[model samples]
Target: MNLSNSLDKIKTFKKVGQVADNLGMETYVVGGFVRDILLKRPCKDLDFVCIGDGIKLAKAVADALEGKPQISIFKNFGTAMIKMDEWELEFVGARKESYQNHSRKPKVEAGTLAEDQERRDFTINALGIGLNANNFGELLDPYDGVKDLKRKIIRTPTDPDITFSDDPLRMMRAIRFAAQLKFDIEANTFDGIINNAHRMSIISGERTIVELNKIIMTDKPSYGFKLLFVSGLLKEFFPEMVALQGVDSVGDKSHKDNFYHTLQVLDNVASRSDSLWLRWAAIMHDIAKPPTKRFNQKVGWTFHGHEDKGARMVPGIFRRLKLPMDERMKYVQKLVKLHLRPIALVNDKVTDAAVRRLLFEAGDDVDDLMQLCRADVTSKNNNKVKRFLANFDKVELKLQEVEEKDQVRNFQPPVTGDEIMAIFGLKPSRVVGDLKEEIKEAILEGHIQNNKNEALELMYKLAAKKGIVNNPDK
Candidate 1:
């Protein structure tokens, strides 16, 4: 098949072909760019594989361009890169790879394009389009990749076992592609993943997380996660999530399977927001239920303090999964901690103090926290779900009223520790901290407005009780 007409969209392909012809090198646009072109997906990056001297071909392509795009050469990997207009173009010599039993890194040697195609993780990715003069735009499919693409199937070019055993990260990629493309993983290929699940230990956490994050960012993240769980690959690194599986019962009183519940929450969050971290919070919201579970004759099953325990587990999980340990991790932790707060306020006499405290604690992330909580309402009874949603709406209305009246979202105290120290002629001490805490508590409890004058007056009353004289100038 010819892609000559399709190549007109980006004339760079013709230029690349001309340059390859001048340099007498066999070149083809290979891998993801070619696959996306065939699939009609929007792609800005292109990968080119040449029979010989990829760096030289890259430099030539750069020269052929208008402004002479700067070429970056990686001599070790026999690859080069160029930024051409809005496109990122890469060049690599066709090579075969041999992996050791202990490592995913492969020993590379120059090989034919056929050999290179054989090394691709998935058959659909192995499709290539010629960029040489004689066979420009010709489709090269050694493993019938185009047929697999048409069938909407993910299959390895080689033996699935050998393919996964060679680079176990491909197992994650198969599921990620299945989710992103809305395709099915071939049964044999999927079974290979389940069979070689333990080989994932050879892959690094950082690499695994990149694929996992991609899966989470897809339209329905739960789809990929289900595949991960079924394949047994999830247990290799994330046993905490695996621990959430199974139903416990004592004389016909069984708790809901938290593993499936978390997936429902993840899908709910994904439908509402594209934030990967928020979706992560949904995944972790009930992670500690297994540990904190208790059965009572009076209450059936209770997962008391699971939110707090789940929040505490976030840091260690992030550390283990090689996820960012910065404020992003903290955001997920905070959401996990505050997930049940709004639900707690659904009682008959929900107070403004509760809403104010939630505003102060959640600040700007209150909306995301509410989103997660609403998604957490996966009860089988429609009436129960409706009631929870209605209460949530009431809580939201009250929060708005309280916030408009008392302005406490991300609230910094009008009274500071330094101000307390200055007012009482004291250095930083327990008295300053105590006064500050009292002022904040008073404002949150609606006893006093969140203003400096009111806080100042309260400070004087508290300071007098402590036998400290008010010395404003000090």
Candidate 2:
């Protein structure tokens, strides 16, 4: 397992080795960097664990670099970091940690390299590449991390229960790594996660969401989400999503399970685009189905107005999960509200007016919205899925045509309220607003062309009806 050639290729490794030798302290590149190296994955950040003062080694390495990169030292944690060009080097003292019953934060004490590796969350992550002069390029696998890597399994360095109980966030990391690497979680480790699922309550929402976002950003995010759902980790942080689970039957009629449907939509979106927010829209598009669900003998099952309800639910969910309250949140809300519009227009006799309205409402997000709608077609009926997809292609063509002709996506009226006020020689009043809405509705409805001349003429006619003067100059 000697990575002597690999170590030689990285000049910084030699520089750090030289610095550590000068300082007379043993150092090794540890954790993710080591794991990724063996996995042949591209990784830039290096975590070095030194048997002596990590801060001192970090300062020495920084000083030895070209720019004398600024070393950021954390005295409380016995760690330091430096950014060398695009590379981030984090240095930490070799230490063992003991966690309390209520907190994930562990009490740290200086220890050997083995102790540092023992504290790692996963065996695959505990692998290390020695950088000390004597053991340079040597591989340390005290936990048989190489075997876990070879088997493509996610397992903790020690007892699964103790590993997870110490930091419940590791449970989320386990699922994330499994999903990202396409690896299987060991049976005992999976059981340990289920047993310690409730312990995640001790983790803060902020910390939990970091892992959640990573899971969402993976190639097939739904895999991680399904893991989270089965492990009961999702219920701990997002009960709203949990509520979307299962289906109720009445008189031999039942709706598809919204939870699994959501996951399918998420996977579909993942296959099409890598936008995290788009995937989020898929997850949330049907979230209010539970509350809005109804069963009628004639209608079977209906989630009336769930879109509006789901849109309303987004803000609260974002607030609860500590997600961004900015435009990203607004984007998800907007998509949820309009998720049904494109589908509704997919039938025969689809009109340009409807496409124009969708274009106007969806604006720059029209493409993403269309992607989501296509992804939403998760029916088991192959013919139905084919029909919906063909219809969506038509819808997309209609959108393109309407956008090119009418130019109504995110349309502001050819005439503004202020322009209307000026044309009619009026102050700020309801009449002005009425006139602006009229022109916008006219363009979106295909009643009038999207042009200033057509809009001006219509404005003049409306002004006359309102008994306002059409004075160009007062």
lDDT of 1 by residue, 257-286 (tens): 999999999999999999999999999999
Please report the candidate that would top lDDT against the real structure.
1
Task: Give the per-residue lDDT of model 2 (tens digit) for 368-458.
Answer: 9988999999999999999989988988887887788878888799898877777667899988889899888888888899989999999
Candidate 2, after superposition: displacement of residue 219 in Å?
1.6
Cα shift from native, residue 158, model 2 (Å): 2.1
Per-model TM-score, in order, reads 0.98, 0.96
Which whole-number lDDT from 0 to 100 does residue 474 have in model 1?
Answer: 63
- Candidate-wise lDDT, in order: 0.92, 0.91
Residue pairs that clash (backbone atoms under 3 angstroms), model 2: none
